[model samples]
Target: MARLLALLGSINIGGNRVKMADLKAAFADEGFGDVQTVAASGNAILSDDREPVFIETQLERILADRFGFKSCVMVRTRDEVARAVADNPFHGEGPQHGSDKMVHSIFLSQQPQQSAFDDLLELHKSKGSERLALGTRVLYLDYVYRVGVSDLSNKFLERKLGVKGTARNMNSLKNILSKMDAE
Candidate 1:
């Protein structure tokens, strides 16, 4: 079995909530092994013999059928996680000024189109936010306002691009990566 990390979209946010235990059981029912949840926010680590893409497709279908909502999930191998963290575009930059909880990263299903980057930058500019960086498959955002007050929600991007994605704080990301590494 190969170790894989799945960045699941909201399973417990808003009115739609899925129990972690039920989610894990679903994966096992679908033939996955060693299924583990990293956080309550829907990050999962598991071992599966199936191809990542196939597993993702299956999970999406199951989630939609069972939970009555559809969200994008990105699956990556252990090596991909390491590389993604190392490749973070905002490697050395401090958070934007006057911001409480500024750092944000968007996990994409694939490398976004150039037009997507252009659009994201334009959006940030219009909002008077200064710092924005796009990496291989992640977009980092720095905000000047408190994160709760900022309009940079994952739902906004998902609607803008007509795709599904989930956002994670930098600390959560690092912890997930570290756990995967230690495994």
Candidate 2:
């Protein structure tokens, strides 16, 4: 069995609420083992014998069939999760816990096209303070200034790339990795 992290897109937002317990039960019913949820924002860690792509598709189908909603989920293996953390571009800028700088990753279900990449790079050119880097299946966003006012937010990425995704803070990413390690 391989451990994977499923980052659900747009769950519990805009009245599309999904209970973590229900999500866990859904995965368990599908025969996944050591299932765990990090926060209510739809982060789940589970072990399955199936491939990551298969599991991702099955999870999306199950949510639609059983839960009555279609959710775009991005599934990443344990190694991929670790790499996302390790390959961060803004790790050594300042204190990680509490500081003016923070890294947020937009976990995308599908890799954005070249046009989308160009748009992101073009946006970064105008906004030098905001640093954006492309990962294997994630987008690393380094917010050096006001996070609340930055244009490099999750919504911004979605609109620019035209892909469904969910953003996780550095702490949340670390916590998920810790949970995966524990499993």
Candidate 3:
């Protein structure tokens, strides 16, 4: 079975409160092995034989039926997770600087067109210190400030790029990667 990472949005926040134990239980009951949540951040690392797309769909259904809210669950292979970290423009270890806590890896539900990506960049050119970079099925963001108060938000990105996404900061991602590796 391939170990997959499911980045879920709005868990323990936005009124979609869900205990990690409950969430893990739901996934485990659905036959997902090694069902583990990464630091209560709505990130689930599990072993499953289903295809990534199928796993994403199944996770969405499980969340809705069992947890009572809809979420865009980005299920990626372990390699994809590594690529996301390696390819990120703001890993805080490179010239493209950003706070590890402020830098985010946004897992896109669908690939955004180059035109849309361009448009987004153009629109937000003067937004703030937040930097942006496009990745394979991912959008990297260096918030450069508090995300809650930033003009660049998930909703804004979704509208501009025409795809839903979920984000995890650089630190969280590294921790998630470490756990995935150990498994």
Candidate 4:
């Protein structure tokens, strides 16, 4: 079995609460061991017999079938998470400020094309309050204002780029990587 981290999109963001305990139970029922949820935000670490992609697909299907909605899921191996953290371009003083909340790291399903970066930059230019730094499989965003009020939240990025992704705070990102490292 492989240890994998799965980030499940909001299944209950609007009120249909899918408790973390229920999610862990679901995974356990599916034969996944060591199932643990990091936070109420749908981060889960588990050991599974299948490949990551299969696990993601099956999990998605199960969620939809059980919960009656489709939610995006991003799965990455422990090594991938560590590499993404290390490869972050704005790791210096820039993200340490209070505005760091505006700083986001987006995990993509695959490496975006070169043209995608240019297109993304154009989109950021329109926002006028965000700076974007592209990585191999992540996009680093720094906003001039708070994240919720900023024009560069994950919804904006997804809309502009037409890509499926999820955003995580820097501290959460580091914590997830640390968990993987400890294992």
Model 2: per-residue Cα lDDT over 65-162, one tens digit each: 87888888889988888888788776555344554237777788778887888878986797667777887668887776657888766777788888
93-161: candidate 3 lDDT, tens digit per residue: 433454588888999998999999999889889877778999989999888767888888898899999
Off by over 4 Å in 4: 92-100
How well is each residue in 70-109 modelled by candidate 4, as lDDT tens digits? 8888888888777666776655435446434445678876
lDDT of each: 0.74, 0.81, 0.89, 0.74
Best by lDDT: 3
| Shift in Å, residue 98, candidate 3 | 6.4
TM-score of 3: 0.95
**Model 1 poorest ten-residue lDDT run:** 91-100
Clashes of each: 0, 0, 0, 0
Off by over 4 Å in 3: 93-98
Q: Clashing pairs in model 3? A: none
Off by over 4 Å in 1: 96-101
- Which scores greater on lDDT, model 2 or model 3? 3
